[model samples]
Target: MPAQPIHTNRLILIPFTLKITKTLMAGDIGILQKLGLQLTPYWPDQEAIDTFPKIIHNLEKVTEPTGFESYMVVHRNSMSVIGDAGFKGLPNDDGEVDIGYAIITQAQKNGYGLEVAKGLASWAFKQPSVKAITARCLLDNKPSARVLEKLGMQQVSTDVELIRWKMMNPAHEQDTIDC
Candidate 1:
């Protein structure tokens, strides 16, 4: 399947391509560490640089596949990889897509997450067949919920501690949320 592109006023959402340079890999590690995400169960911290070759090899397989395209959310002004944002898994006929994102810890609370999400989700809506975009956030994550709201997504349901927000028309919204 062909990957699609997403663009926003501040971001350029390109398709996921895994080419882990020594520098980028190192930056990934540092960014993860600063975000406190290294402690997350989904991905563990790399204890050594030697382990990156194997890690990158495995990442190559995970990154390049249908329904899973990651984008390095670069800041238009700074031109830095502040974080990663993407859609993972298959969205159903409901026009829903599972949105995922993680910004470097230092970048949080600066409104960058909401900024990138608006761009990415808007881009996703412009896809050939996309009708809506959905995102799940831990119920305790008020910031994420706010970001969803900023993108004009409304809460439709919940699972465990997760709250689901869906946006039906990102391309047409004038002002997304009260925030």
Candidate 2:
């Protein structure tokens, strides 16, 4: 089955398909209309545009999205894609997956970042293969650090340039219970 859209209180995370990523990379706004989505003036910003090729390459590896790739972050109220967020890919050998999110400048500070991160983590934990989710932010990016902290992730380590964080799935513990 195709991955279903993940709905949070204020946003809908639609998994990016090959077609959507290609169209967006081609600089076509028609894809927005076709998907019944609106675009914020700040969306498709340079970072998002640059990520399309990677998203496309990942999408090509699977016949359908497994909800482990990029998703369009749409505001529930405006139906406008404010940004993008999702897992970098499937879980690693250790059953850990890395996540990342970006909300357009105009949509920042509305708690959307936390909402989307929580939603993604929640969805990921439901997958039997996912035991933990990880993320990273620059040492100077306090806002991003705050979002990760809000999602219950702990700062596992840090390099000169980046802070790495991780959150283990609570359900994984329950599954290992000896009762």
Candidate 3:
């Protein structure tokens, strides 16, 4: 389960509960407000629009370890869906989890991406089992690379097709270094 709501400088990260995700998949955004989500109706990004069906399908068929769930990024002032961000799955045995996010084209470049990443990573770090958050982006996705970099995630590995970034929980890192 997620906390009340993960807040950032310009956005609110609302975890998508089963009811909310199901409602969203059913094409009714109005139900969200009544579900305790304090925001305007949702408007999924092109990516969210395209991938939500699969997301719903997977959520129904599988059980995630923990800390992996979709979150809606609502613009604080406008109370609107600026984009979405989430972990690919719960942290692994090594305490690493992959993350993914995207903003609607219109909302791009306004620092929302970094804000969402920061908010999500902060939330994940609150889970004692989560040690680090990781993300991968296509080499051409400079904006995403910038978001990860701005969130203090280092470029840990790269391949011809993508660059991988990771940021360990600061407290956990300090504990390790102090050992």
User: Which is the leading candidate under lDDT?
Assistant: 2
lDDT of 2 by residue, 8-126 (tens): 99899999999889988999977997899875577899989989988998899889998999999999888999999998888999899999999989889999999999999999999
lDDT of each: 0.61, 0.92, 0.76
Tens digit of per-residue lDDT, candidate 3, span 25-120:
777777756755445333654577676765565456445323476777778887777787787665789898888888887788888888888888
Q: Rank candidates, lDDT, best first.
A: 2, 3, 1
How does candidate 2 fare on TM-score? 0.95
lDDT minimum window of 10 residues, candidate 2:
170-179
Q: Which candidate number would show the highest TM-score if scored against the true structure?
A: 2
Off by over 4 Å in 2: 174-179
Q: Count the backbone clashes (under 3 Å) in each candidate.
A: 0, 0, 0
How do the residues 39-130 of candidate 1 rate in per-residue lDDT, one tens digit apiece?
33222123223344543453465545343455655556655556666776445665567787766665678887887787767666666556
Instruction: Report the error of model 3 at residue 27, Å.
Output: 3.0
Off by over 4 Å in 3: 32-42, 61-67, 174-179
